[model samples]
Target: MAKVSVDRPVAPSAHPPPSRIGLVGFTTMFVIGTDTFLVAPLLPDLTRSFGVSTEVSGWMVSGYALGYALLALVAGPLSDRRDRRRVLLSGLLAFSAATALCGCATGFWSMVAFRFLAGAAAAFVSPQIWASIPALVPPGRIVRTMGLATAGLSTAQCAGIPLGGWLATVSWRLSFWTVGAVALVVWLVLLRMFPSVPAAPGAAGGLRATPRLYAAILGRRRLALFLLGYFVFQAGNLGSFSFVGTWLTRDFGLSTGSLSAAMVALGAGNVGGSLLTGRVAGRFGPRRALLLGLAVSVALFCALPFAPNLATALVLLSLIVGGVGFMFPVVMTLLQQEAGDARGTVASLANAVMYGGTTVGAALCGLLITGLDGFYGVAGFTVVTLLTSTAVFAASGLFRADPATA
Candidate 1:
């Protein structure tokens, strides 16, 4: 029932290697993620440059995120109607332009406008990769290829955060300029190497049709359940993750340098796991592998509070992030499969929920971190949420391939 890609897609070859599409996917995710992390390190400089209170400066972060999250709903249905290749290129061009414009901003609101545009443009780019992958790759390779894309974000957390800080030392504008330049290079490569992918056979995409399309998609009973499960999955994962730095500083008395080093170690584990977890998919299938990873995360969280030393805590954190890496591709693949031809719609929804989960998680954990005696509140809350999400997935009955048989 799925439409074959023909007009233009990420790759055009009859039997293109997964790595080729994955390469562009990785680069796209990395560029967007780096931009996301870049603003945090540059915040102080941004405040001084814009002559705003620290609180007002936080709008730069929220403004970018608002564009990214809100526009995804619109971009999704639009990508579903056209050649994703063109859509991706246009998004890249717009994203690149807006990123560069951030360097030229004369005042606070102009900078926010540029960042919002950059984020909105970015919303269009990633959905194309996620949507086109199934049509572009061998069936067996879907989850594996998604893992390669997932690696991009972990890599950004590891490398780009510090790079942004270092660039900020010279000038915050340099950070945007650097990422924008890299994005331009990526756009060129994708333009040359990518091929055409057409819309789903029967989809009628128009601004007017957007509401009907979403109404139909959301009307599906199983998919709605699946999306709910994914939301909770992210809520627990991100909630626990958001607190790691605070936990380290409080429990270990680690300074900024030591905390960064510890975070890098955990991030490295995430990157490694993201790159390698495809093998787990090959062996156990995506659903089983993901459940296995979640179980491991639950165990890790359970043990983390009891860790007696910095080394022990770091080891546990690394494994936990690695488990997250192991889980990501599988969950994404399942969500895409549930999407059927609505890959773009589902991908955008996924991103939206991911941000929502992080926001809600961080907010809730703020209270838990302060309320319940050391890190136990965070640990206990995370464990309960993980288990609850796992239960949701189990009850949804979506994993029909069954880990039992695999």
Candidate 2:
């Protein structure tokens, strides 16, 4: 708590206690996650301020995704080569600066540029939380701690979106300023809580060894297939999710306020499910938890297309997202186990594919809806991808029990 002795780098053997580090990791992830959709409600103000069309104004959102997607691939390797605390602190510093800069933007491109910079910096920030959990916590606590960290993201979305929207009602710039200020405070907390984590085994050979380290993971067919499976999984998963808002509006005739309330409810379910996952996975093991969550997700998604009323639709949507919440941390924990020492590389790749999946799923679902009509298209596509992911994970032996980890 007393700054982790900054004059000298603290090694993992002398790392901060698991309980303390876990809280900081959770807080670290929450602060970063809170900023994720903080810009959503500001879009209208942004459009007016920039004198741009709706589509052009969307570049603000697109800019963040673009920056994150592009930088994560690079951030992973860079993270593996140094003390993760250094990477996290450095990244958070940049994130805080860029976020605050958004409130001071002079014009459209400058705002977009600042958003992009914040996002790029975030790519470096969030993944470190994921990558560091294994090194910081005992093996038995890894899955739960990961779940705790994961809950931070879903919970942040539940909390942050509404907070940002409210702040936007006051002033769009106020949202950025508030998030920036929160991030700075979180930075100070992390500076004290996080120790300088030892680099991965791959880091031993220094900069020249980075390529070989990458090749080691790439050369393995199973890991490659697992990544491919994850990519497709994200595509269907995000694709269906992205259209839920449109589906509710078109069919249920919900107003913007109604829709926001519904989304918050769904996010609440997701937060509950994520927290539940840790206990369930801890008791029954991740394999059973994963299977059960996957089955539930498939059923809920299949049933979603048939909801006859707003109540039914909301229940089905909530269930679907809840199931998704349960599955994510288990999948992530399994992936981390597989990665062992190279957690950053895998986290980065997984993160990148996740964004890629969101992109593809959104586009593909749009076409599906055009052809098939309504939520049916999105739900049907999601079901297929979910099933495919199950098969791929099975084939990759991702569900196997690890002797070293619970």
Candidate 3:
């Protein structure tokens, strides 16, 4: 396969310029991120539409994560063995189709099935974008590029819920349809603008080779430790976030409109953090940035239960989300560097670990919330999980600064 160079500026360049590639990646992630987050806000509409209870409708969200987590393990290694462009395009097309099908679902189970399929297809798409960044940009710019991509995802998380809620006022299906259309546009842009990235030299072995490849990647102590830390980190972040609406409504007696407004603050902080992460990581080094963010996040989690009113809780939550935002690109860059030749596989596993963490954290919080303190139990869970993550990072000895770059 011919190599496509990405180092040049966008003046009739043979390779797509880095900026264009970044745009495609950001747009793709924004669509997928929006889809992932939009479901939570639409649960009430879905429950009414399908004639199901809220608890049962909640499966739509869980099912998406479940499918994405399981399939990401498979998609990651498979992309390593093929042209990443092919895997990404194929996944996007399938994801778009599945999302459109979701809008057409006549019952709850059908919606769940389509959501699961959409998530599975999406698992194949995002890891390629993550793995390709190191290949596409100079090392100095890689983290910044990652920050851009992370910002797109973070922005989606910030906007998706409220956007979905507003759209639900019109019709819940409109959000799905809109996402599908946006995905299709992104798919076309990717096909036109994405530079061709060939498979790794030894990566083209068939499905039978997957097990050995994954085993080899997982056997690396640094990679394993980092992944463990990532899982714990996400569990804490998502576990608390998963119940934010419930907490606001139940504890503070905030209405839906007020809750949405509060989430905007949280989302804005996340976007700001993402945009700032590259500079922060560059100055302090990824390890220090990671540690600092983790420390601040833990402090915020501990303080959340004591917030005096709705406004105070929102401010605290924003800061907490911002800390997680700062950590996002730093951890991703570290993981990609550690993965070496198996970056695609490692990227996939990282995503899987995130979803698994969210699932586990949410489940634990659910159990905890049934106690006397309710949301306070969730807050305590966040602190404990974050502390565990910090311990893993410290013990791994991989927390040293990277060599200073220009």
lDDT, candidate 3, 69-131, per-residue tens: 899988987887777889999999999998888889899899989988988999999998898
Q: For residues 1-406, what per-residue lDDT tens digits would candidate 2 score against the true structure?
A: 0011111224547766778867887787777877766654455566677897543554566566567777887788788777888999999999998999988888899988898888889989888888777677776676667777887878776777657656766677888888888899999998987877766443443445656666787677788778888888888886666556556766777654555577687878888788788688878788768877877888988888898888988888778778778888887877776675567877887887776676567667756765675688789899999899889877987666645555
**Residue 29 CA displacement from its true place in model 2, Å:** 1.2
1 or 2, greater by TM-score: 2
1 or 3, greater by lDDT: 3
Full-model lDDT for every candidate: 0.75, 0.75, 0.77
Please give the ranking of all candidate structures by lDDT, highest first, separated by commas: 3, 1, 2
Off by over 4 Å in 3: 1-13, 44-58, 105-108, 255-257, 370-374, 401-406
For residue 287, give model 1's deviation from the true position in Å. Answer: 1.9
lDDT of each residue in 211-314, candidate 1, tens digit only: 77777777878788777777777666775565566667666776544555665777788887787676887787878787888888899999988998889888
Q: Quote the lDDT for 387 in model 1.
A: 89
Model 2, residue pairs in steric clash = none
| Model 2 clashing-pair count | 0
Error of 2 at 45 (Å): 8.1
